[model samples]
Target chain A: MLDLALKSIMRSKTRSFLTTFGIVIGITAIVALGSVSEGLRIQISEALEMAAGLIYVYEESDQPLFLAMASSSLSEEKIQEIEDVGGIKESARFVMDIAYLDGDQQFGQPDLFINGVDPENEELLVTESAELDDGETLEGGDAYSATIGYSLAQDLDIGVGDTIELKEENFVIVGVYKKIGDPGLDNGVLIPIETALDLLDTEEYSGIIVYPEDLDDVEEITDYINENIEGVTALSTEDVAITISSVIDQIQIFTFGIAGISAIVGGLGVLNTMIMSIMERKREIGIMKAVGATNNCILQQILTESVIITFFGGLAGVILGSLGAYSLRFISSALESATVTPSLAIGSLIFAVLLGLLGGFYPAWKASKLDPIEAIRYE
Target chain B: MSKTIIEVKDVKKVYNQGKPNELVVLKDIDMKVNREEMIGVFGPSGSGKSTLLHIIGCLDRPTSGKVYIEGKDVSGLTDDELALIRGQKIGFVFQQFNLIGSLTALENVEMPMRICNVEKRKAIKRAKKLLSSVGLGERINHLPSQLSGGEMQRVSLARALANEPDIILADEPTGNLDSKTGKEIINLMEELNKKGFTFVIITHDPLIAKCASRKLNIKDGKIWR
Candidate 1:
């Protein structure tokens, strides 16, 4: 029976290939989209862990539509009150602005972020992950010294003792931080808060980072700052992580919905192919019945043919999806932050086979129930 | 005084029963074939000879009355049980040379044995021997489409003999063959009959009927021997 099924599928090579191609497309969509979303989720969680036990106090309007344009800074009195919060261990006021790198056109129109942070408080809050590869970190009241990130140093082809111009003022790079894999920090240069205010002509800070005395105090400190500090919203790192995860999950659901539709269409393709095959092989089935083949044999043959087609289709889809994920560099360079790793789980292979079986069942049952006398005369 | 291999008693078949245009194909057909006997059923088109062959082979059930094979009444058997009997005790050759077109000659011949769950090596050996005996040894690998009408019928004959069945029910076995090839097939059946294989051949040709040990004429759904 298996031999007969194989021969029958081989007999109609074009039809079999077209049917399998549908499954291939469906499985490819599932695997590729699944990997991208999974990679995004992993990267977001990792970023959150790097900034763990810290809270961010940003000024923004309640309306989501205007949140991007709402950039009110905290007043000095509000900052003092937040510093006096019970569970707050340390607090840092930071200003951020985009600055062009001096004579670095390696990346077309190179733009680097300049962050102004108080050296004493910045060092206390900067996670242990941010290590200096060479030279000392910026000291308090250092007006001419700046610390460069690993990628920024590489972009300008400079290290410690090198000077770079920002806003027509030269500053020496006293330290180069090791790679942290965070895009914002990796491409930024850090300098003193006073120098940043002098260059940007602003005295107010953009945001503040607060660290709690203990990990368990993070939530209490965030609550305290939100209740006491006016015109500011305090968010724990975990809350930010959750918000990002939920957004990613929504995207994943939408992507999988599309993939599911494709898979269903693929199953219909298999069903169509099986029905046509049965129609063509009516006389042949009659011959088998007359030669002592039971109805079960006929059913098994049809199902086996469908499964073989889809199994191979699934295998091809896995290989193709993996190749697509690995070539993310061509798809989008932004995906570099998230490592796209395609997974060929055993569950997915089983899903492919189940799809074939579902599509093949009704047609096979119809074939099995055909009247031998009529079938033999069916031409 | 041989034992009876097939006995049909008062068997009748009706199609589309109780409908506006009901038709009875077979009525009050009583027949018996002893072991090793070559019985020919002759009739014109629409004479229900094929329907009788189907009932005798257990491929279809009678609307009323009983069919007995090897002295056991099979009219009440389920479809699966009838299929088992067909696989074990009976083989059928069709007028159209109904060999599965996708399979080779050897594969067609091996089909019945495989249905009986014969092991791969054993089925292959027997299939080769059957094809060789039917003069299809060199053509074992040729598909039905590649074979001539006579060669295809020979392959079908080899398939019929695969299970070493007690009764070979051949429905117009040479109906699609040329006169010469038809005569050759009749000779082959006669040879097999001489080797103690019983045959119930349905044909419209008097020349083919004359080859049988006993002939029964079917007309208007009744058997007239």
Candidate 2:
């Protein structure tokens, strides 16, 4: 029976090919859209990982969106109170200075979002593997030491051991860090928090870095700071993660919703193709049933054909979509900065297969229940 | 006394029971066939020969009355049960030959046996024997389109025998053949009948009726004496 069904399909090569193509298109569209959404999620995840150690403390009553846009400073006394919390391995408070560095001289000052950091705690938050084009990391008591991103270094034409004059203060670059894909790491300069404070000429800190002895104590210390610290909001790594995650989630939801439309259109294409195939093969189906093929047998043949076409198209689409996303990431690395991962490929392929199944149902059912006499007579 | 292989008890088939267009195609059709008895039903067009055959073959339901094949009542059987019985106990050869165009002559013959769950090796062996018996041993691998009308009918005959059916239902099996070829097919069927294969053939040709062990003349939806 299976052989007969296969032979029938082979007999109508043009029709079968056309039907398979419909499934292919559906699978491809579904996979491609899913990959885009998955790629966006990974980009956001990496961005959050880059900012893992930096806590963005805000007023407990502050609206999340408002907190995101608001720029506020923490007092030195509040920083000390946060430092006193148990599990706070260290703390540093500093203000941001928007200073541009052109090797050994100042460039037009760019609007840079900078955080004052204690030399000890700065290294903890800065990705340790972060390489620089020039200069060394700031150590407490090292006068005018700084590190810059590879992109920033390239823009300034500076390399390791080069001098960068920021806010009229000349500092020798000890270590130049290779740029991370995240926006925070790619186009910024990291100077000693005290130097940033001196440059801004303020004792107030832009934000504080609170290092926990263990990741589990992050929330506990954050809560303690929230209750005891004044004029400052306390946030842990998790709070920052949740904040960014929620925002990314909203973006992901919106994009995924848009992508879903294309996926559905693709699914409908598959359904339309399968329906036509069923219509064309009505006589063939009757012939099969006449020859003792059960409904289940017919159903299996149709489903197998559908799944096979879907699988092939889905796999191809995933590969193509990943390449597309990767190409986009490669082009934007210099500008926005990020890597597209392979998880998107796997995830989209799965969704494409599911969509294919959804698309295959009605037509397969129609084909299965056709009466032999009527079907055999169908043109 | 030969074994009674099939019995139809006053079966009536009415189309569109509740509609103004209600039509009666078969009215109280009574039929019985003994093993090895070759019967011919002669009728003009619309005499309901095909409807009677379909009811007897369990491919259709009657408006009223019962059909028995091999002594089992088939009227109340579910679709699956009817299908299983058809696959196991009956073979059909239609006026159009109805060979699956995609299958080779051997494969077409092997179809009924395969449907009966015969193993591939055994089905092929039986198909080969049947094809050879029909004098088409050399054309086993030729598809239906490659065969002449006579050859196609011979393959259909082979298929009708593939399941070792108790009876063959041939609906104008020779209608598409030339006169000479038609004679040859009737001779072949007669020879098979003599070998203890029962047959119920529906035909319009009087000459064909002359070849049967019994002749049934049908008119206006009922068998007439």
Candidate 3:
């Protein structure tokens, strides 16, 4: 019977192909969509963890959480005090301000995140946003040297040796920062910390970058800062990681919404194909039953066929979808952008196959329960 | 002197009960067939012959009345139980041959034994022997579509005999064949019957009926012995 069933399935190549096609499409959608979304979430979270200068310091204040939540500034004195904690090597006060790119393009003003730090310790706190194509680094007493992200250079139609006007002052594009594995890095701008602080014209800084002599003592130093310091919230690498994870969680909720829709569409296709296949094989089913096939046998035959289709389709979909997602990552990376991870590839494929199986179930059952005599009698 | 293998007592079949379109097909059908007996049921179209065959073959249940195969009452059995009985005791050969078109003759013949839980190697061996018994040894690898009507019927017969069933129910077995092919099929059946295989054949042809050991004519769901 098993042999016959297998042979029967193999005999109708076209029908089987059509049935498998629906399953394949469904599975592919699940795997590819899942992989790309997971990849995006990972890339974003990783970028947030590696944030160069953004800092959150803890201090003893009347309302610490409120102060952390507030858009108000942290005093330079408080920043300096936090910088004096044990294991702290050097600290730079950073001001969050935007620098509009002077360009030849016809778009609205694209403001880059221009950060401020001390000229002596600028390199300690400020990491390049993109790899330099052809450029020079910042130097003291030189008012024109500034590093710009790769995308910023492209947006402003400026490159190394080109001049970019910052706040009505023309600055030479001395260096292009390296492109990080993030989209946000594409538009960031870096300059001498003192230069930015003077340009923003504020004694109060948005945040302060703290460097610890012993990286392992970062937690203890953060705890000491919270206990002795005033008017700020301390944020360690772990805290940043948690915050990025939560942000990614929110992103996931939205991605899941899209994935959920894709799953439903795929499931519907599976159900539709199973139902149509059942209808087409009604007479054949009845004939089997009339020849002494029990209801279980009939059901098993139909269910097995459904499962087979689902399993094959799911497998194919997974391969194709993963390939697509992987290929997309390659293309993006070749253009020097973030990519989806290969680790999430399997989850999508398995999900696709499961979708096929779940979708095929009810229709297969319906096909199995059909009265054999009536089925045989059906034209 | 042969032992009775099938007994149907006062079986009834009704369609669409309690509805305006309700129709009765079989009313109190009673019959008995001994082991190795070749019994032909002759009837016109819509004469409840197929229904009788269905009940006797255990493919369907009688609305009322007991059907006993090999001395066991099967009317109250579940569909699965009926399938076991059919697989173990009853072989069916349909007018259309009913061989799965996808499978070659050998595979189709091996199907019943496989359903009966026969091991693959043994089932294949048995099927090959039966195919040869039906004079289809050379065409064992041929699909149903590739075989002639007579050859297909032979494969169908081989499939029916796969589990060594106690009774064979052939419903209009040669109705679709040419006269020469139909005669050839009837001869194959007769030879198998002589070897002690019980048969219940439903046919409209008098010549086909004449080949059986006993003849029962049916009209409007009533049987005339």
Top candidate, metric lDDT: 1
Query: Which docking category, incorrect, acceptable, medium or high, applies to candidate 1?
Result: medium
- Against the correct fold, how does model 1 do in TM-score? 0.84
What TM-score does candidate 3 get on C-alpha atoms?
A: 0.78
Kindly give the number of clashing pairs for every candidate: 0, 19, 12
How large is the interface RMSD of each prediction? 1.0, 2.0, 1.8
lDDT of 3 by residue, B1-225 (tens): 439888999999998888999889999888899988999998889999999999998888898999998788999998778878888888889897877666788888887777677899998999999999889889999988898999999998998998888889999999999999999999999999999898999997666778889999898999976
- Give per-residue CA lDDT, model 1, range A1-379, as digits (tens): 6787788889989999999999988887777776677777876677678888888877756653124213546666766767778877788978777666554456542367788888876664356567888897888326988888887887679999999888888899898888765555677788998899899898777778888888898888888777877788888989888777888889889987898689779989999999999999998887778777788888888999999888888878776766666677466534554333534334445667888999999999999888888898998
TM-score of each: 0.84, 0.84, 0.78
Q: What lDDT does candidate 1 reach at residue B84? A: 85
Model 2, A240-274: lDDT tens digits are: 65776787678667755766666667667668777
Fraction of the true interface contacts (Cα pairs closer than 8 Å across chains) found in each model: 0.63, 0.24, 0.43
For model 2, the superposed segments whose C-alpha errors exceed 4 Å read A1-26, A29-33, A36-70, A94-116, A127-136, A140-144, A149-159, A162-171, A178-182, A198-204, A213-216, A334-347, B102-143, B194-196
For lDDT, candidate 2 versus 3, the one ahead is 3
- For candidate 3, the per-residue lDDT at B118 reads 85
Q: Please provide, for model 2 over B123-218, each residue's C-alpha lDDT reduced to its tens digit, 9 standing for 90 to 100.
A: 999999999999999999999999999999999899888888788888898888888999889989989988888889999766678888999988
lDDT of 2 at A361: 82
Docking class of predicted structure 3: acceptable
Q: What is model 2's DockQ versus the real complex? A: 0.44
